[model samples]
Structure formats: C-alpha cells, structure tokens
Target: METEKKFEPRIVAMLCNWCSYAGADLAGVSRLQYPPNIRVIRVMCSGTVSPHHIVHAFQRGADGVLIAGCHIGDCHYIRGNYMTIKRAKFMEGLLNFAGYSPERLRLEWISAAEGVKFAEVVREFTEKIRTLGPAPSFEASPRLATAVL
Candidate 1:
C-alpha cells in the first residue's frame, strides 16, 4: 500500500528590493509562516520585470508567478510600481490569450513594514496555485486552457 503525495505548487516570486523584499525578510525575522514552495528573485524595482520574465518562468517549470512591490505613492523609485501595474495587466491578458490561466499570475503591493501581509499573500497564492494544478508546460498534452471550455 502506498499513500499519494499531495500536489505542491512551485511558485516563482519576484520581489522589489526596497519594499516587498524587505517585507519578506521581515516575515522571516518575525517568524511568520509561509509555504516553502516559492523561489524568490530580488529586483531593484518591480517595473523591471518584463512580460518576457513572466513567460520565461512558466516555461521553466514555475506553476505560479508573483510580483510584489511598494504600494501606490510609496515606490522608492518614484512611480516604478505604476509601470509594474501596467505591465502586470498586459501580462495577464497575454497569459489568457496564450491559452493559460491568468489567475496563475499575481501582483501585490507589500511595503517593507508589512511582513505579516507578505506571508499571508504567499500562503494564499500557494493554495490557489495548488488548486489550479500544474503549469500547462508540464502537462503531457500541453492542452490549451480554452479546450476545456
């Protein structure tokens, strides 16, 4: 007899150095709990995360992608996150157009002081990704999401 292992999503998180990365660090020092499934990439600003990076992560076995940065009006680089937001929308639409679920992508505004929130966001997103199952690139058929409909 064998027990089946549960699905654990592999998440790639891109965190802005000034705010979201600090928040994640705070979560660690504060002892807040989050899933270990995320592989984090530190960026100077979220605006630098182009759509190519998001698609590349998916192609490279990431089941979900998270981009976190400073909240509106709080960006250290002065409106960098505003560019992030615009790119996020475009990326989401691109995901949908490419026959993948847009829900696999997430954007959050996590200030350096919001460690608890960072942990919570990771936990929640992991659960969502788990529910969504593996990334399409991992599927044997590479079935288009639209095919299910």
Candidate 2:
C-alpha cells in the first residue's frame, strides 16, 4: 500500500488588527488564491506577539510562524510595529540558537488594502516552509524527556 503524505505545513500567523488581519480577511472575501496552511490570530498590534507565543507554537508542532504588521510609520499604535520588528529579530536569533530554523519565523508588513500581497506572501512563505521540511521543535530533547520522566 502506498502511504499518502500530508504536504500542507502548519502555519501560525500573528496578524496585526489594523493592517495584516484586515488584509487576510480581504484575501478571503476577494477569493484570492493561496495556501490554506496559514491559521491567523489577530492581535491589536504585532508588538503584542511575544517570543513565548512563537516558542509555544513550535512546541505544539507548528512548521512555520508568520508575523504581519503595519509598515514603519504606519502603525495604528504609533510605534507598535517597531517593537514588533525588534522583538522578532531577537526571537529569530534565540530560536536559531535553540536549533530551530530562523527562516520558519517571518516578519512582514502588509497593509489592509493589499489583499493580493497578503495572499502572495502566504503562498510564498508556505512553499518555503514546505521545502525546509518539518521543524524538530516538537521532538523532545533528551534533557526535556528526562525532566518529564
């Protein structure tokens, strides 16, 4: 018997309410073509998304995480995206040091009017993650297992 493999990557998307979330909703309403792998969580601002959320997603078996926010100087909160960018950069290094692919965590700027761009971004990011294969974050380390036991 041939075993069928699931090709869809599990994507966790943290979208800023003022921009990226609206963009994603527009993508759906406009019937834009894209992968269905992305599961979006709307936040008041991207700055609300912490490294802990990304780490938790990884531990729960998400293959990729995308954080979408407003463009620089366009933040609804006057500087929330700046914090988002800095925090995401720091998290990238931390995740990489912890043996995870930093590429799996992406930060992007998507405006509410850019539905097509949102769809395209999702498609592109999903494909890149597929090529990178599944993340090993779900696999318990020896020390972690010992602690559990």
Best by TM-score: 2
Best by lDDT: 1
Q: Give per-residue CA lDDT, model 2, range 1-149, as digits (tens).
A: 99989777999999999999999989989999998899989999999998889889999999999999999999999998999989999999988897788999999999999999999999999999999988775665798877878
Itemize residue pairs with steric clashes in candidate 2: none
User: Which stretch of 10 consecutive residues in model 2 shows the poorest summed lDDT?
Assistant: 134-143
TM-score of 1: 0.90
lDDT of each: 0.94, 0.93
TM-score for each of the candidates: 0.90, 0.91
lDDT of 1 by residue, 1-149 (tens): 99999888999999999999999999999999999999999999999998889988998889999999999999998999999999999888988997899999999999999999999999999999989998877354636566865
Candidate 1 wrong stretches, greater than 4 Å: 138-149
